[model samples]
Target: MDGRPSFLIGGGQAADAIARIDWAATPLGPIGQWPQSLKTALSMMLLSSFPKAIAWGRELTTFHNDAFAPILGDKPQALGRPFSEVWVEVWPEIQPMVEKAFAGEATFIENFKLTIDRHGYPEEAYFTFCYSPIRAENGEVGGMMDTVMETTETVLAQRQLAVTNAELSHRMRNALAMVGAIATMSLRHATGLDEARRQLSQRLAALGRTQSFLSGEAAEDAHIYELIEQSFSAHPNLRQRIDVVGADFRLGSNQALALSLALNELITNSIKYGALSKPEGRIGIRWDCAGFRFVWREAGISGVEAPSREGFGSKVLMQFVPASFSGQARMRYESDGLIYELEAPAAAIDNT
Candidate 1:
């Protein structure tokens, strides 16, 4: 009765709009008049244009905006009905969340998955939402406000990436098997223990090279010319004694290391027990490829037999070569000298 005409003033207009006035049929009368400022602010906030809604009476009422109606198709019709009555099917799953929110506790969930049957079509969705307690005039928890966002696409994409990585690993292992087979066939006929051991060591070195390459490792390849140059560098007098005649072939990182070691062992053995040990002896190293197969031979060992039992050098040479490159080593003894032979798949020997 102050006759201030609260509705006529700017602040009074807001209070009047915020005041509760039931839209659905209810047992209680219209909510007592509220200040105009409070009413105006609340009227705008509850304009039914958002996707989330406020629930009163323990989520029994839908203070929903138009934005939330489509997602809850028929629920809007039961505005003042008990939540359990309207969404009884989902009650068990949603009950705990509602209880926590109503008990004045804030709860948050992320990427929460759920399946909803919409118009007979089941749709899966991921949701992130928070339930916050809403307070009443007496400062007591009255209901809850729900805010949510959808994130279905991002979750599915990550699952797909995991599957792709597994497939890649399988293919890589299969390709390695093929390479191993070629290395074994390459050194199948080395004429003597010394010759066979040298070829075997090379193949093993090649295998090590492949492993390194797979892990993105790199190093210089061993060139036949370079090996010869290094060998002769140690003995300027022997430089003319050894004959290396062949077109230099480029080797892949894998081939380079293994072949280099094999050549090194051969040279060392020749110096100690082969033709190089005799001032009048000569050594010849040569190679040729036919179709998909490569052959390499080392001749001139002063017609002497290398040890049969093998030493550390022999073990390393034999085990590494064929095993590394998937090839084989062969040894033969001739009245003339020793012959070490190597034969392998073209693919394994091809530098390209």
Candidate 2:
């Protein structure tokens, strides 16, 4: 012995492991025989707060610090093992980088993916790290030092946010197009400028209500009964005049929007001229199935007749809304009242 105290005398757990290593049985030989350059590098790595490790000599004996131990996970024995064995799970992916470092070319990778067997099972991980050559006294690259930081959480969060932003942009474009269509149709059907303005404003407000409901974080598929109830929430007395009966089911986002718009048109017409135009009139709405089959019935009104010309409300209820779901709609204007029926596949309304 050189009669010197151990190099790791007051170091942390990783340093203590290195001190207990049987250096004489290893390719690196005894600590007393270690080169001054290797000793200096090890001393610096042992004191680092950042996760770091040194792979020394031709054998690439692994040595790391307390901060780096958790990175090894279940493989605590990695402290004195060969670097190749300690990280065998990702050797194929990292071998080229390690070889480059050994050749005196430093390598830096960000958000690098590796499937590692670190927690007693294989799991994917992302990292940002650098591998730089460690030189000997003769100025030759004899080993490599790794400084690493895990970036898995940060990378995943950014990716998720990007997806959400893309979806929102698409929805916004669709909404603007719908608004343009509603304005054009409303103006064409109005008898005068004031009538056009009033009709446009009412339709826009209806669109706004539907959007508000869908914008909620907890909003997913909407319940059929809840959607109908929401449409009449503004008119408490109207609730008593409306009879809703059917097995309730959820409507997908697009389906909910279409149905809400159609109902708004129907309700508006009824309150102005149809069944709900008189105190004695009443309305009944019913639906069923995964693919909804709906019926709207109005009664207690007399001299009901089909309009001479189809307007925006007629096209929305009898054509556009039905076509959107690849379904069919029918309307009958009997002398007693107007009855509307729509049939579409449940798949059209299933948001999930």
Question: Could you say which candidate leads in TM-score?
Answer: 2
Q: Which 10 consecutive residues of model 1 have the lowest summed lDDT?
A: 10-19
Encode model 2's per-residue lDDT on 229-313: one tens digit a residue: 8788667788999999998777776778888889999999888878988888899999878567899999988988778888899
Where model 2 places Cα greater than 4 Å from the true spot, the runs are 1-13, 16-25, 29-33, 217-220, 300-303, 347-349
Residue pairs in clash, model 2 = 252-349, 290-346, 291-345, 291-346
Model 1 residue 343 distance off true place after TM-score fit, in angstroms: 30
Count: clashes, candidate 2? 4
Give lDDT tens digits, candidate 1, residues 1-352. 4343333233232233323335334632344443333233334435534456556654355444445556665433544556565556566877799889888899899988877544455577676778777777676776667766666677777677676566446535643563454345434456666866665565455444444443343233445465446434545777676666667766554555455555555656666777667777676666664422223333444457757755434543566655555667665555544556555665676366
- Quote the lDDT for 232 in model 2: 84
**Who wins the lDDT comparison?**
2
